[model samples]
Target: MYKEFMQWALSSDDSWAGLILRLTLGLVLFPHVAQKLFGWFNGPGLRGEMQYMTTKAGLPVWLAVAAITVECVGAFLLLTGTGTRFAAAGIFCLFIGMILVVHAPNGFFMNWFGKVPSGAEGFEYHLLVLGICIVIMIQGGGKYAIDKLLQ
Candidate 1:
């Protein structure tokens, strides 16, 4: 069972697709992670983000913390093609939650042209992230991945 599990998790038959997906997801998510963790991109820093997510966003403190950690750590993992599946799964769940809890209420279209009242963006971006994550989970980390080295 352990051997089978390792085989499934570490296998990387297709390289380019996973490479593209992993890089894309990592690049896109890294900025958001930086925003929350370091206040880069004019985002709230860790303390501020925690407060806003828990108070305004109504997310539990633990969940908010987990989200922040996952985004930051997962980005690095995906970028290096190490633990890509786990990172993808983490990001997948995070985007899905964001869609359900935050973006869905805003409707399908993004806040393009600053038209939305709440100024919150829509779920389209989250859906795209989710799709990428799904592809990563299915395809593994491809060539250049640490998983390949393990194999």
Candidate 2:
């Protein structure tokens, strides 16, 4: 079982497409993770995020912590092309939750012009990220990935 799991985890193609998708997703996610984890980019950081999640978002402390951990660790894994599928899966689920919980009422288009009364954006960005994650989950990490080395 362990061997099979490892094999599946390490399996990947040699195409550049995986590399491109992996890097794009990784890079895009990094700043968001940093904001939540390190307070960078004017983010609320750990404590603030926790309070908001538990209060405004009405999430349990454990789920908030898990989400933060997944965002931080998953972004790093995606960047290195290590555990690409797992990382992508985590991110995919995270975005799905975000869309359903936060963005669904705002509709599909982003509030580019601040026209929305709620000032909340839509799910278009989440959908795009979800699409990227689906591709990465299917293709694995492509060229220059650590998964290739492990295999």
Candidate 3:
């Protein structure tokens, strides 16, 4: 069972699936980051949201800054597949922190609704991104990724 699971998870084929995952995660997350960094797409912008996260949400300023840095600026790296593996690592850690620190109080574990489990406020998306990041990390960026050129 373990061997089969590892085999499936580590398969080298990353064309369609990686393309879909990369596009979807990047597009879905881009707006949120923009909202935090810029006022794009009816977003709150960096100053406002980061302030709120610290004051209203009681988050440490550094953590808030890190979130802003990762979600907004770091997202560009992920989208462009420029240093894809490292960008994915940042995103994965960010999501993990969000789950443990922010959402866990709402629920201890993910609400197993789909392949990538969700939480009280649609953690499904984060989990999906996490899975995609994991896949991409192991297989590396595919087709149009900058990693290909570098390699």
Candidate 4:
């Protein structure tokens, strides 16, 4: 059972498409993870994010923590091309939650020019993330991936 599970988890086909998706998505997510985890890029950081999610967003502590952890850890996994499908799925779910909880109320299109003044931005970015997640989930990790090496 363990062997089969490992085989399934670590198996991946070598393809440039997968590699491109993994690397691009991973790099894109990395800054957000750093911002959330270390307060880089003037982000709120973990503690501040937790407070905001709980108080302003009404998310549970556990959920907020989980979101942060997934973004941080999953970005590494994606960057390393290890468990690409699972990481993509996790990111997909995270985007869904964020869209439903936060971005939906803002309507389509990002503020872009501070047109909304104080209103939140739209879910356009979330849709892009979701699309990328779907692509990665379908393709898995390709060349240079630990999964491919193990396979």
Return the top candidate by TM-score: 1
Whole-model lDDT, candidate 1? 0.88
Question: Candidate 3: where is the Cα deviation over 4 Å?
Answer: 1-14, 108-122
lDDT for model 2? 0.90
lDDT of 3 by residue, 1-151 (tens): 9776544333334476665666667778888887787888887788899887898668899989987788765578667766666677788899887876667566444556544433255365567778988977776555566655543
State the lDDT of candidate 2 residue by residue for 1-151, as single tens digits.
9999889878999999999999999999899888887899999988899998889778899998988888889999989999999999999999898888778988899999988877889999999999999999998999889987876
lDDT of 4 by residue, 53-151 (tens): 899999999999998888888899989998888888899999999999999999989999988988679999989989988978777787888877765
Query: What TM-score does each of the candidates earn?
Result: 0.94, 0.93, 0.75, 0.92
Candidate closer to the true structure by TM-score (higher is better), 1 or 4: 1
lDDT of 1 at 139: 91
Error of 3 at 97 (Å): 0.7
* Residue-level lDDT tens digits of model 1 in 62-132: 99989888899999999998888888999999988888888888888898899777788888888889999
Clashing residue pairs in candidate 2 (N, C-alpha, C atoms within 3 angstroms)? none
**Residue 21 lDDT in model 4?**
84
Determine which window of 10 residues in candidate 2 has minimal summed lDDT.
97-106
Query: Which model scores highest in lDDT?
Result: 2
Off by over 4 Å in 4: 1-6
Every model's Cα RMSD, please?
A: 1.2, 1.3, 7.8, 1.6
